[model samples]
Target: MQVIDADTVARATPFERLVPALRELFASGAEVPPRQVLTLADPAGGAAVTSLVMSAWDPGRYYAVKVINIAPGNAERGLPGLHASVLLHDAITGVPLALMDGDAITTRRTAAASALAASWLAPADAREMLVVGAGRVAALLPAAYRAVRPIERVTVWARRPEAAEVLASRWRSDGFAVTVATDLANAARHALIVSCATLATAPVVRGAWLAPGSHLDLIGSFTPAMREADDACFRGASVWVDTEEALVKAGELLAPMASGAWRSADLRGTLAQLARGEVHGRSAADERTVFKSVGTALEDLAAAMLVQAAAG
Candidate 1:
């Protein structure tokens, strides 16, 4: 098997390439099985260990398996809280083809997916962007948003005000108008809002605070017990997801569904429908659009395919 490091993966897959690949993978007629998650908890540290396994097949073209480990406190030491690796194999022969850095693949594919969703769901004239959380994903949001919208102003909010300011400064140096917001409500008032934090139990942005013609992308909260958006958020907007199966299991849609404010049918459609033109997106200029992403195996498989091809 060819070993691929993070830098190699970054060089191999670009956001532009991954976005369309993901769009096509979802739009194409294919089958991807649900992911399996195994969890281990530490009562003393008040944390849990999670291992995720995802598999997908585009039938005769490719197949892949991504395994990820999640430990919440690893971020305290300046390391990513989540780590992952992916294995690509020949569909016909079952031979191991490539081993890739799953963390980089995950972030890139996720940002690309969010950007793709924004392209269809957000207004074409969108000019402002707000991102929650100052982690690696937060740093990538602006580039992803700019790919889809005409984002002129970028605002960032995190539990640590200093970290928010730091990220804002970095973005400013990169030639974008960036600011740090003390209140998440103030951040939510932007034209496009991206949530990338790892808070497990609290809602950061309130649905009432969202402006009309706004696009919200919730990329955190990968488990049923975690929620970034409140029930009212779902009630106030048209909800779209990467996949209905993944969303129903663990996504921003979970909490609202659990609270009785929303139902499974409330989901207007999936990214595949939107991309394939089967479903309408942002019917009106003033419509509130929310895209809830729980991440997907097909996205990883698609991205890994691109990376592997580029590596060769």
Candidate 2:
């Protein structure tokens, strides 16, 4: 197995390549099997284990699997909260083709997916962006926004004010106007709102703060217990998702469904439909839109394929 580090993966995978690859994978009718997640906790020992396995298949030849292990206590020691590995295999022969670091793959592919959704869902003239959460996704949102829209400024918000300020300071040095907002509502007032947090309860962004012509990307919630956007947010906007099945498992959507404000059938359409021209996206410049992503395995497969190609 060839060990690929985060820097090498970052250099090899660009949004230009990964987005188009994902579009092709969607166009070719690829399917990601249900992801498997396992969690273990021992209260007295203060140790927990969380593992995730995601896999997807292309038409005839290839399949990929990404396995991740996450433990929460590492952050106190200045280590990543999660560590992962990805494996690519030939479908017919079941031969392992490549092994790579999954942490970089996760961040890049996720940001690329959000960018792809924004490109198709947001108004063509979007310029300002608001990113919530100061972790990996917040750092990536600016780059992803620039790839899809002409982002002129970015505002960041996090639970820890210092973390948000630090992220804003770095972005300002990079030539973009960046600000750190103490309030989530203020941070979410921009043309685009991107949320990436792992908090298990309560909504970080309220629905009323979203302006017309805003595009909201809720990326943090994956399980049935976590949420970033409130039910009112869904009630006030048109919702689109990367896939229908994935959305069903997404906490951001499931919460609203339980409240009766949203129905499973209320989903506007899939990203595939928009990409294929089957559904109209952002019908008017002032329409409110939201894209809730649960993160798909197909995205990892698509991005991994691109990274391997670029490395060649």
Top of the candidates by TM-score: 2
Return the clash pairs for model 1, or none: none
Instruction: Give the true-structure RMSD of model 2.
Output: 2.4
Candidate 2 global CA lDDT score: 0.80
- Candidate 1 lDDT, 12-124, residue by residue in tens: 77776777888888788456787888997878775687988998877887788999999887777687788899999988888899999998888888888888898888888
Per-residue lDDT tens digits of candidate 2, residues 1-312? 456778888888777777777777777767677888888785767668798989987756778899998888778768888889889777788887778889899999888888888888877777778888888766887877677788888888788989888889889887789878877676676545454554546788888888887888888887788888888888868899988875667888988888987887878888778778788777887788899887888888887777777666
Error of 1 at 137 (Å): 1.8
Model 2 residue pairs with clashes: none
Taking all chains together, the TM-score of candidate 1 against the true structure is 0.90
Model 2 residue runs over 4 Å out of place are 39-48, 72-79, 190-200
Candidate 1: 10-residue stretch with minimal lDDT: 191-200
Q: State the TM-score for model 2.
A: 0.91
